[model samples]
Target chain A: MTTEVLTTTGAPLLQVRDLQVTFTTPRGRVRAVDSLAFTVEAGRTLGIVGESGSGKSVTSLAVMGLHRDAEVGGSIALAGQELTALSEKELSRLRGRKMAMIFQDPLSSLHPYYTVGEQIAEHYRVHFRSGRAAARRRAVDMLGEVGIPEPARRAGEYPHQFSGGMRQRAMIAMALACEPELLIADEPTTALDVTVQAQILELIARLQQERGLGVVMITHDLGVVARVAHEVLVMYGGRAAEQAPVDALFADPAHPYTRGLLDSLPRLDDSDDEPLRAIPGSPPSLREPAPGCAFAPRCAQAAAGTAQDRARCADVRPALEPYRSPDRLVACHFAGVPADAAGRTPANVPVPGPATVRPQGTDPDQEVSR
Target chain B: MTTLKPAAGPAPAPADGSAPPLVSVRDLTMTFPGKRSATGRRGAPVRAVDGISFDLAAGETLGLVGESGCGKSTTGRMLVRLLEPTSGSITFDGRDVTHLSQGALRPLRRHLQMVFQDPHSSLNPRQTVARIISDPLLVQGWAAGDARRRAAELMDLVGLIPEHIDRYPHEFSGGQAQRIGIARSLATSPRLVVADEPVSALDVSVQAQIVNLMERLRRELGLAYVFIAHDLSVVKRVSDRVAVMYLGRIVEIGDKKSLYEDPQHPYTRALLSAVPLPDPAAERRRERITLLGDPPSPAAPPPGCSFHPRCPKAQPLCKTERPALTVAAAGPATREVACHFPGD
Candidate 1:
């Protein structure tokens, strides 16, 4: 694909450094995003995964320059332009022309009254400065490109007229209408069904390859990361816990939070009898930043912190450093699978099928075992 | 996924071994009136759920799964008489209960209940846990003091602390709120409870807690559930027999093991393939069947099978004639599928 070649030849499509986002709620200033940084290369998909309120969405919003009434500190460079240095008017011009985003709920993203084609055409004309006829034609072409059937007729229908999956397809078509270089998808398929969700993920991956677009796919689902992402950044308590190639991260996740996240999801192959390793506690709040490792409270394998290792985690934050592999970087004082455990698949393999006999109301099996 | 050995002994046949099913649905259809055109005339009606049939044996849990606007939710609502059906019959213990007037259905209402998806929203924001659980008992005309005691028992049965009774819905977590919702549904000791995506709205950690709690309650209370959800993994875990839904029809129905290990319908295969496997090695190698199109609009469904537009193995027969649910040649006695071209 042209995107893969472009990523290999040129610079990363977008580069972020030391990004920080803070919000002032009624209670106090909340450090929602703390020193977060990552890069999205052309044709490459960078997955940002974390639970709710873990700053995954906030970081994405910061990249899009969409957050309001919040203080942002750090550098966000698109291609060769520094977005943090751009004025609001300059950023506005860059939004649809250079970058676009797709949200979780397409129902709210698209204007209901306007036909899908009209909205896409409006974006086309506004950003591309094409004539009405040309823009309308482009809208239909884009819809067809996104795999929507009967695009000519379907494009004229309002958002409410389309089904959930169709509306999402339309939203994808609109996001690609402008052919933006960077596509920030925030839980784009969370509201979709498994089959439809897979289609959407494939659609995004296919489009990224065909259009040579860099994608920042945000989600709370690791299954998606395993299949679609070229690179992944596991975030916890507003910080990047681990970042590595998809294969590397899955093979040996260096951070405790990443391991915990992977263990929490129920596997399809697990036999109907094995118990799921559900992460016991929820993600920690960032209101009062932890003195030590943010995950220490929930980390089952928290290493013994003497005066040295524990001091940096509490007061001086650790830098994102290369862990065992050169490509994989983790921001933790203690990172890496113990030397002996290296090259071995964790016994925690989720056996396929139904999980083990769970106490009622605890497993999805409750509905079947009546 | 875990393997399920058949429950001990011959799976108990019907309550009292009666020939009549505990719940019977015949030719059930529902249509929602569409909006009026610009001329103030009604537009075409939307056939949300076309004619369908099924039976629920006493103590059995039937699972319904499908995408949005596929009428899965509508079907659940109709079973409990929450929404009026445009056509068909719903018989409870051989008694025709469909079309009963609100005043007349009150007595039957005590036997059937529903648990909604979002515990936070399903519960009253202003009412305390005690009041919420007592509402159903009070509706049944139970004495105030007796209702309070029953509510407390139900709360404890659901694993909530006694101190939680005085607290409002806002005070509890998502899982706790769901426990309260379950407690309220059990207030009247209903025979069947239609829980619609009960755990889909919560976190993964919390989902297990709620599912386990529901299972224990069922064992202890002898309550049955019509579990509705889009998550097949969760459904397969809970249901004894599973019903695979597409558009507005049941594509496949079978015992839990048969449905999970050897799904009969192409749609079921696709749905199963789409489920994410937690194990990286297995996930990388599993065969995936990608479906083609979105679910068709119910208002004007396709000429024949609603799933034809997206079915990978769709044939001419699928487009020309609707399929009927029939016992599969290689399936268990309880297994049935409504597809001309079923299987991967």
Candidate 2:
């Protein structure tokens, strides 16, 4: 049966609120994503930045309704239509029609045996119920739109024959063949070289402007986000550590984790020989999270703070709320506190001893056992 | 930084007005046979590395930056003797080790080592951390007990707790595992370390930790590094001098500051422009030189200049004649660039 899809006036193209994804493993129930919320308007990009196991990919999968075995709880809306309440068939109809996704590696994503043109044509045929010749012609047009030279000749080649960059372009072409209004690209440029990455990003930007498509760009590289994203969301330990407009996030990061991430990156423009301020501890395990704030144990400010402030950090979980600016949100107990007032200690500052002692229970092995 | 005594050897005669470099490579080339074409005939050989030359001084870092398939990895592999070069001369510590057999190269192997890209696969999953870190010493015929002790020390040096030395590589995170790889590479106190994209696979925070540790190790132990990576920013932080490779050839080589601030070659400029700065203000304001197409295939590189097809400022001369690596007239003579039109 067709589901009633409502279109709200002035609503975002995609809206996610209080999203949580929990996976049932043999060991226990693991929380892959926790309370992730964001919105993407037409022709704008919202970048979800995080390291491995921070739930960025899981969030995307949950949005796409691809998490078959996981327990997904939250509100995900596309053009004001509630997606979590829809049936599998209804979701499938919307997946490649109203929304599309491209992954990190195009080699595995594209079919090896079929011709590139045939694959794109099939993608189009399934969605639009078009004739084979018409679908083929559309595929060729798409290939040319993506800047592939001699589209008709190249479309006959198999996935194996295409180069890495060309293969990615073909994937992009297939994704955009139906002209979806929303696109989710998970680490699309991670596998590509710098030059090719620039080209692919440029292509996606140009297409987004042309189609007015809402794009969700997922990557661990902050540089990528700075270049293309209008807004940024920083994820840590399966939660949004910080979220703000790209300019605000870079200029005045509220969360200590966000500050640490930015400070750690080696800048090409900076010629300083000083050592980088690396975040002290590894990421926490999702199976059993720490007591209060997930980042507290490794945060230098938390370590060096007054006893009362440190106790509050260890006992109370901070909610994602406005910090410094109305648009900026941070999940830290002392989000807007100045560095000196918060007792912030410089990272990588040499301890006056043989070797610095690691904070208790911060080790990955210890966390796994606990 | 404490000064460590140089390894004992007959110091070679001063070359080019200074002490001879610790490792010198000249005219290095590596070609791999390509697959057969549709006509059932073998295709041309892929020139993975083509006549590239460089020198690494003691305790210095020479960064090799390039995109995928640009022979940066191949060049790193050749330096550590992991792969045999089709043609080249590799001089190490005043001795030519280019043609040395495996048996003959054993003694000199202690002076050269490599840290691979993937920490997960580079390390043996089944082996204990101690065994993994001490493998070099064990190969060199060190006693098992001594090797274990040395491995413990190395763990401490790389910031891993000594108690976890008995754990497997699977027990550690990506960054920790990379540290184990670094510790293993330094087990024999090699004069030169070829790190192939060592930090690329790690998280940004963890990457800084590893970079700091490597920098500290370079000062403490006086180890030379040939840091190869695709990230220009990371390379700039750790390298004294940088080399830009494109289509199996070095397009530019100069001091890190000079090359980054005043890049001569168009390819080098394009590469620098392509890197997205973390600062949004600068990134938005930056004038990006978007290259048109992917780099030409290494196996069938374009005639004359391989980059001529994509170069924005390409001329007829670039399409007909390949430019040799030559010193630019305006800059320091040591700053060499392989471009017909050297400057903007």
Candidate 3:
């Protein structure tokens, strides 16, 4: 069973085992990713969802073998190849060839002077050992695949000439140009307006289906996760608080922190009456080694005799275990609610609607309950 | 010629038979001088804000929604004469203050205030909350003795402790610093406040708290607001009416529900469809209207309708003619759209 879980049809697309990423700054040593472990099966999407400072980016960076000033521990295997053992030059060779990443902001990731075609072709040349003319032709074809109209004309225009959405499409095109086995997208659509955001989501979805690629999407948004992710990993202060199938995680979150995050999100169809329940307190700073559970400071479930509970959460460090079914794994001390809990039925469970919708933008209605 | 008026203080026993809007912006147009490219030749002048017009009732909240570079922020700054408009007029209390000189606008500044996006950058680094809030009152020449009292009241109104007034801005959280900024904006008793992305920098929970306070203050003080933001969902929640802008033009303007539930303009519909729904079931069912390309450069917008290149309903006429802002066939006073084909 362990072998079957670890390897699918011989080798999993990407395997992360006790991956730890730490950064040393003037302030102190920050453990950005804390003993995190997860796997992304081929032709599937695994979402790592957390708020700012939750170490989502650090984890993805560690997977790409990209963090410069950080100490990395544990093993990341791609198609059974251990990436940590590879030399810098070897890793560089594998970067665009086997793995690719798309950043949140296209404007920052893309060079202003180069045309979209040139940048995509540059990545292709670095990996494929193809002729420049052949690379440019491939770049234009990839651009068309990402839904950019008039790829031929657009290939000649510089990055500055493209709008926010178009630039994002160009970024996706570059990532796909290499035909990598795995793709890492870090909030790739956060900076875009929703209309463009939806298009990008669809584009990624369609490409992933067509390519049979494993995708690791990192975002702070739960909504995006619900739409695209097949499996979910809920992280808090660098640790995976809970992991399960997308529907199962939302239907019945095992961890208190996961429960809190789910409650905080404003539902789109919410009626204008329910008062929003904001998660109390803030995420703890990770400047030093944590004493107990990192979520204890903000968690409401902690009690005086919780020192016993602390032993399990803080000292023991709960491992992921099957909760509902054999497939669903949750890493919480209290993996599932007791059978007699009052809020089990749909009538009692809070169905989020518009009234409790929390505003996510810079618009002024921040406080209006409606 | 209808004149705009500054939001008056509690009416003095009903002297005037009727009250007009606090700030009336009639066909306001703002054009900025764009720099020439490396070719040493001038490019088309950028219309940061084109002929856009709106009225701010004495105490109503008007939300301006658009993507970045759509000129909502420029429009906010122009309302208070921060950026001088090339044409049209902004009347404050029946006075045309659009082209008012800096010196002449200073006194009028007491009645209009702004809350900027970055609290840390907006607040003076060295100044304490007391000083920050008191600066506006002091600039209006309030006596030093009375300034502290008014500042304390403003701080308490925004839920900041009066005792912490002497603490510097760096000592506070993002939410706290924003409260300090809000305290300062209200210190002068400004009737109209232009808040540009006030809560975008804070956490979800903290954002809720700050937004709630703003709503409470709006009701209690009966102050008007020209709220500018990119988040349409939040705009729909708080605004009585929302105006959608694209390439320096108001593509659609309607009451919150109508604009959101039944957006007439194709651009407005596309914008609404972009917002991701939280529910797994609902999200899967919703048909998203995706725009194909990036918005055209505002500097050299498409010749006909600025949005024609990316607009889904664009026709031959749309490619050659700029559509005028007019009432939609749906015929709601709050529902006016500028489009060749306004689809609900």
Candidate 4:
């Protein structure tokens, strides 16, 4: 199933397993991400979709070795090299060269005083130990590569001088300056307008194609997921609700939370005659230890299920396991059960739209063969 | 414009476009004085809402959509009289309320209310949900007991547990806090509600819940709405007619069906195309009209069309002469587009 594909001489670009991130807050210990697992192969984009406080950003920060105060556990490997075992010094060496992340806000992510060009040049010099002249040239080249017109003039301008879209493009240029093998973008286009968002998404798609980079796009927008992701990992209540190929995830979501999310979206192409089947309750709080399933309280299927089914959901924490097919994993008690016996909402989420409207971005062969 | 407080009129004749509109706005404009320089020289005044006119039939939702700083929010505020317009007329229920003083505007406020974006920030964190919802009713001379009871009912109306009326805003989730905001907006049973990006801050699942609730309330209460948001899909779901604004002017206005399927204005086409569809195959098949650059600042908007700088179909005449919002020359007669080459 896995080739260590795309660019030659790679041992699985990025692999994460049993990843757990916890924080010591004033209130108490908060488990931001719990028992989440996913992999990103070279030339393929892995989308991490979740709501606010679902630990999407936490997972990205952990991958980039940026979580200093938080307690991070479990294995995070890049090209078969263990990252959790690495020290601060070693991790710093790997950060910009091995992996880089772009944040939602470009203005704050960048320094206000420094020229955009200088920041990119400095980042390049830190990672590659290049001199001023060479790093400067590299920064301009990256700026031009990212489709920034008049790169020479724009590079000298400060972040505040650039518009929102231009600032984001500059941020992308800075992220790709060293040509990192892996890129983790956390809501990269959330702050920009829809027009600008499309341009940035297109730019990212083109750059990924040209460089064959392993990309992890974290966002709350399902439309972006449908457009860019080869595979999707849906996070809920600090846990992986479901993980599957983009088409399967959208077409036939196995987890109740996943189904609720898909049904909840008011699509542009679809008619809005029927009331959206919104998930009934708010997101779960991570303060307490969840002995049973994290989503049992809000899962509509469990609510409509039998006493035995409800008890199983509330008493046992369902493990992330293969459902129907090994490639599609679902964390739910009633995943593979018959539709009529179990509630119909969970397993039968696909509205006969999968085959006819399958997104074209989930071609694994192209990613592998390129 | 100081007419006696007339009786709260009967629920406006069901829209049908035949009856007089519940709200009629013409040539509305707001000019916010620019910030002063270090030398104390004031900059050019920002014309936030340029000359824009529209009619909102009773019980109909007119969605206002545009990018940030495009004046959709400004237009919404003007409708509610939160920000007084520098020039133009605003007639509500056949009465001119454009320049009504705060004292004179108080009675009319019961018929018009606004739901702001960022529910948490808009709501007072210190106040309990009961007090928050009942404040409007109390101001309108309802007895204390009656106002509080109505507050509880409003909470239940918006799907919140009435028993938890004493809970503070922080105790609730993002979705629940927004429900309180909605409850507060509907407190006085306003006939027209101007919601400014009500669901943008909410998660997708919760956004759906709120949208459905709002739709139901509008239907059951015979309410009209001016839904202002940046999200096209949500607006499409809730609106009967939609107006697209760019740089302080509405570039396009039409029925939701006509606007979505066949956008006439170049900027509208680009904006609609920019909204990524959830369907992947459709995304692959459709062509996107990517605007060349960002929208020009309203402080110094382009001379002719505000969109001329980035417009793909802009001509020499477009650069020199401003295009007025007029009926499209071709295609759907159901729309008014402000472009030199609409439906080209």
Candidate 5:
């Protein structure tokens, strides 16, 4: 994976600060992303995790400068250069070469009529200013680069001819064709099956390492975040709920929403007797200007506290502040999980199986379970 | 009404072993006509479901899970006679309902209800919440006034505002719409409900709400369910017993604890491995088995063992011999596996 990127020390590869994105729908002004801030360094994956309507996808689109009907404000910098101020033509020039994005549905992203190889070749030629024959070679190489078997033959086939996983691989191959320094994958593996999802995640991680590309992964699945993310920023109502290292966040989530999310998900290892402790209410509507904390209504701690605690939480929006460690951020006024007691919980370990579980190849059990 | 007798005839059986299973499926198969090509030649018939069998005791939950086109949805449909099985029998409390005529099946519709994957699409867009919820009751010979009253009661039961019964589906959020779908499924107080990926469309937080609601309903009503989904973790959360499907066959079926903790069939193991666990440490330590390729086309399935093509533990014998479903020789005798070399 030969590539060229600005290899500067001290500064991060991609910097986003106070990024706000709003849509003017018939209903009202919907602030999809509300002053969300995060950054990604080269060779690292920053996962932006949130549920539907949390503005995770909108953040990715704003970075790519792809929002047409929405207003985007604040700063998005790549390689120390601001992107929000760039013109459409200027951004287009930087898109395939400097930064690129992959979406959830590969079929919709890939053109149906054109052969997969020809599309990749066209994209490569447009960005690199190369001849068709030379670009075609690069396209086939990329197909092979993403681990698609029979790259040459498959390149000649259309998107419809390829399977779901192969189509996604082709999309990744095309996205990395110009060797972008920054990659924003918005729910890239959401549409894929779990097995294929693992393969794609491994491919991206490998490519990120070899090319030293900064990656921002957006998804609702915590498992995907756990697998690939070095740092995670959990979003709620288009605002930052919590931010920390992957292991630390999962070990002891500071935000109530994050805690509720972890509680809601049914772990494979947990006994069946325990009913899922789902959060009582649904996510807040972002159509209106939400006063105070958007999550106060659903926050269990706020509800259980005294009248003053509840009033404070409902009357004032909690700013994203450092939670114990400077690196960790939580946006709840009453965020729990004290730093002194942040022990690595055995919640990460699965209950051991009996000796007679799998005798044929007992080793696989160690890989899947604790 | 005359149509209510068939469904009411069966005395509610005890969930214990003292009575037979409420629902017993044996070698159920479904084959659809092949698609005709531009050249006017038809392709091979698709065996969406091929000889799969299971039993669901009263109030029991059977989780049917597989990847896309593995026939989990098709199996769920067949249980409620949505799509008639091409072969084999579906016995409901010792009564064979497989080949029953539509006229004869009318009463049984009250006993078995279906909650679809997409909440919005399954419901009528033109109808109000009241109309949507009362449709089943109306079909079961209830008067309009009585059904409407029942609809309002159901709204409150499913955690929806009773006043909102006059509102349209679009007015409600995704989670609320799903609640309406659950409310409709329970309109006639069904004995067995087949929920085909009911919560897959909603957000993670909202998914918890739906799962909790279903669990509460199941406990209160003593209802049996065939929970169909692709997510293994969610299946493990709700199921008493689970069946792993591959290329239209039940490769493995057993008690949820044993099967998930120690999967017998190679495909089941691989399927379980594919699921991404939420904990980062567990994810880092756990080994994953990536299957070679996508599941083969059901239209032209592979010879002998269907999973042999991508199976990690597949042997040459798997290529020639189609293993029949049999009781496990070691460990749990209740577990049934179809692979020649089952346990690792």
Candidate 6:
């Protein structure tokens, strides 16, 4: 893979620092994203993964300058240009040309009344000021580039006329029409089936290879991150819980939240009948987060720790810093604890049954009495 | 927990055997009207679920997995009597309930329940959680005090705090709302639950919690589940047997181990290969079988085998002769597939 080579060779195309997004609601001020930071280099993918209310989508929206009413703070830069300092007019000019975004539901994101070609051409014409005919031709070319069959005829159809996968392809064609340097895809394949998801992911990876585009793929599926992302950022309670290379994050996750997520996932290859280790509590409320670690209340390690360790967890928040490995960053106080030492239950280890009972995996013996 | 176990009796026979299944369908089919054809005449009907048959045993999960529009949801609705089947017979516990009138179905409704996909829309926002969970009991003629007590117990069984029973659906998160939905489905202590894409709309972590809860309930209550989902991994976790559907037909049906490990149908193989595993090493090393094009529309399906267009192992016979599901040469003797060439 050229991902490792491309990641270390050049400056990051997108850098976010101390980003915070808060929305004023009727109940109170909701801090959706708090002090989140990450960088994405050209020709590489940075996958942001979390459950609902984890601020992954909010961070993407903040980078795209799409939040009109919410209060956004901190720094966001694109190719040496500070996005936070740019005016609305300047940001609009840079949106489709320099950076673009694709949403999860293509049907809702796309205009229902307009032809698919007209939408794509309009997106291209806005930035290039090209003739209508030229833009239309580019639209057809882009539709073909995304592997949509019969591009010329399909381009004339409305969003409703196309299938789910084709609509997503048209959405991608529109996003890439202007040749943006950065692409922020928020759950691009989350709405599609597994087969279509694989196709869309392959298309994105191929396009990124050809254009060296920086990609920020936001999704909740860790399998997707393992397949496509160069680096991964795990979020919890509107903050970054852990960040590491894709392989490292999967092989040995440092934070308890990440570990719980991995253990909870039911693997297709695994055929064991053991119960899944579900995370005990739901996600925290972002409006009034815990004073210390956001995940401390639900974390198994924090519950089993000594009084001093528990006090530190409840009183002082831990900062995201390097743990053991320089490339891997974790926000947990006991990040380096071994799995068994942290009271993590080993999965798929069979326990002995009652003396009179037969083993679980084998067929029940008819001779055994009740 | 030990007292919860039933008497140690002989293992139940396969639902496909001569013994009657808890829920049985013979030649089930459903079709919807479509637009006119190019000849300006009435077009062919859209075959949502065309001539499919399967069975659900007591205390067993039968996973129906397919892509969107494959008619899995339509089949689920038919089993629960929510939709009138175009043509077929549904035998429940030796009684034919296919075309029963609404008045006659009232008594049978207590034995079957359904859980929908979108928790937000499935639940009524105006109603309180207590009212939602107790509605089934109320419909069944339970007293008000008894129904409320049952609803509270159901809430605790599904891991929801009892104090939040009075709150409306809008107050809970997606996961909590799904728990409420589960509680409502179990309010009648139904024998069969047809969950149509229940956890697909939830987050991955919350999805695990719901799956675990459903598994535990099945064990404790001895409830049979018709688990329908597009996620193969999730289906594998919950299903004892699985039936893979494509273009409104069953392409393969077998035990979970046989179907996943040695899929006989080319479509099943492609679908399994497309799923991304969380292991980076395995993902990088595995070879993928990408199908050529999108599924053909059900209204205008191909002449012979519907999967011929995208099948990698398609032959000339596949274009002219429709295959029938039969015992496969490989795997278990009970395993069945509708492919001419059953194995790689």
Q: Per-candidate TM vs. native?
A: 0.85, 0.94, 0.87, 0.92, 0.92, 0.91
TM-score for chain B in model 5? 0.95
TM-score of 4: 0.92
Model 3: residues with Cα > 4 Å off, grouped in runs:
A1-9, A112-115, A254-256, A288-290, A300-323, A326-370, B1-19
lDDT of each residue in B1-344, candidate 6, tens digit only: 23223332223347866566888898999998888868888877899999998887878899999998889999999999998899989998789999999889988897789999999899999999889999988999999888888888888788777777898887877778888899899888888889999998887767888898899888887888899999999999998899999989999998988789888888899999999999888999999998866788998899888899888989999999989988877746768889887789
Candidate 4, B232-285: lDDT as tens digits? 999999998999999998899998988988999999899988997766666778
- How large is the interface RMSD of each prediction? 7.2, 2.9, 7.2, 12.3, 12.3, 10.4
User: Per-residue alpha-carbon lDDT of model 2 for B225-255, expressed as tens digits?
Assistant: 8999999999999998899999999999988
lDDT for B69 in candidate 4 is 86
Best by DockQ: 2
TM-score of 6: 0.91
lDDT of residue B170 for candidate 3: 77
> How far is B236's C-alpha from truth in model 5 (Å)?
0.9
Real interface contacts reproduced by model 3, as a fraction: 0.34
Q: Write the per-residue lDDT of candidate 3 for residues A1-370, one digit (tens) a residue.
A: 1223335657788999998998899888888988788899878999998876788899999899999899999999988989999999999998977889999999898998888899999999878889999999999999999989899999999998888888989998998898887899999988887767888899899988888878999987778898899998888778888888888888887877777666655454555354455454455567754566766544534321133443445555566677878767766665565423334434443222322222233222222110
List model 3 lDDT by residue over B1-344, tens digit each: 00112346433121122667677887888888778879988777889888997766777788899988888999999997789999989987778999989898889898889999888899999998888999988888989878988887777678766777788887776777888899898888888899998877776546656666777677777778888888775676567678999989889887776677778899988887777765566678988878876766678888888898888788999999999999877656667788988874
**Residue A110, model 4, lDDT:** 95
C-alpha lDDT of residue B79 in model 2: 90
- Which lDDT tens digits does candidate 1 get at residues A249-366? 8878888677766665545555657444544444565877776677664453442333333345455566789888788889876676442322224343222222122234432211
- Model 4 per-residue lDDT tens digits across residues A327-348: 8999898884543444454553
DockQ, per model, reads: 0.31, 0.58, 0.29, 0.42, 0.33, 0.38
Task: lDDT for model 2, please.
Answer: 0.86
Q: lDDT at A226 for candidate 6? A: 91
lDDT of 5 by residue, B1-344 (tens): 22212233333343446778989999999999999999999988999999988888878889999888899999999989988999999998688999898899998888899998888888898999999999999999999999999898888777787877898888777778888899899888788899999999987887888887888778777778899998898999888889999999999988889999888889888888888889899988998888878888999899989999998888899999899888868647768899898887
Q: What is candidate 5's local distance difference test score?
A: 0.85
| Model 6 chain B worst lDDT window (10 residues) | B1-10
Clash list (residue pairs), candidate 5:
A359-B344, A360-B344, A361-B344, A367-B286, A367-B287
Candidate 6 CAPRI-style tier: acceptable
Please report how far candidate 5 places residue A114 from its true position, in Å. 0.7
* Lowest summed lDDT window (length 10), candidate 1 chain A: A361-370
